[model samples]
Target: MTDTSCIEIPEESSSEKVQQIDLLYKCISKLKEADRVLITLVLDEKPYEQIAEITGITENNLRVKIHRIKKELTEIFHKYARL
Candidate 1:
């Protein structure tokens, strides 16, 4: 979603990694439960079809939703990055 293939998880200092993890949790916590679950499954590398079946959504619709969710995550992550 949102071409996340371009995003590289940088090797960071331990403290920086912890801060990034904290920021990620904060961002994810703001999502609705369904969105949270979807994102989590995506993060876990679950297949789209499987995720769709579990969430009772069509694959196309789930793709769109995941794109939007990733966009939101990018925005939230940037907010924390700025700080």
Candidate 2:
């Protein structure tokens, strides 16, 4: 989650599922190994401690990484929304 380009994808359904999936594919492709795990844990709304446990990263490190990921997602959304 350190890319600052990942968007806050919705949980609700829409006719644009395919399009959203495409976007997800593109964004996920750019993530690093650690970022991918962090992103999934976050999408599942897993708690901080859980994320740390699952990732084997310290909670403080996880928090910083999550912040970076959120920033990356924001940038990605801004760039891809027009696509």
Best by TM-score: 1
Clashing pairs in 1: none
In order of appearance, the predictions have TM-scores of 0.79, 0.68
User: What is candidate 1's lDDT per residue for 1-83, written digit by digit as tens?
Assistant: 48988899978899988988988999999888988999999999999999999999999999999999999989988887898
C-alpha lDDT of candidate 1 relative to the true structure: 0.93
Candidate 2: where is the Cα deviation over 4 Å? 1-13
Worst-scoring 10-residue span by lDDT in model 1: 1-10
Candidate 1 regions exceeding 4 Å error are: 1-11
The C-alpha lDDT values of all candidates are: 0.93, 0.83
Highest lDDT: give the candidate number: 1
Report the C-alpha lDDT of model 2 over 1-83, residue by residue, as the tens digit: 48756768668577588878778768766778779879888888999999899879899999999999878877886688876
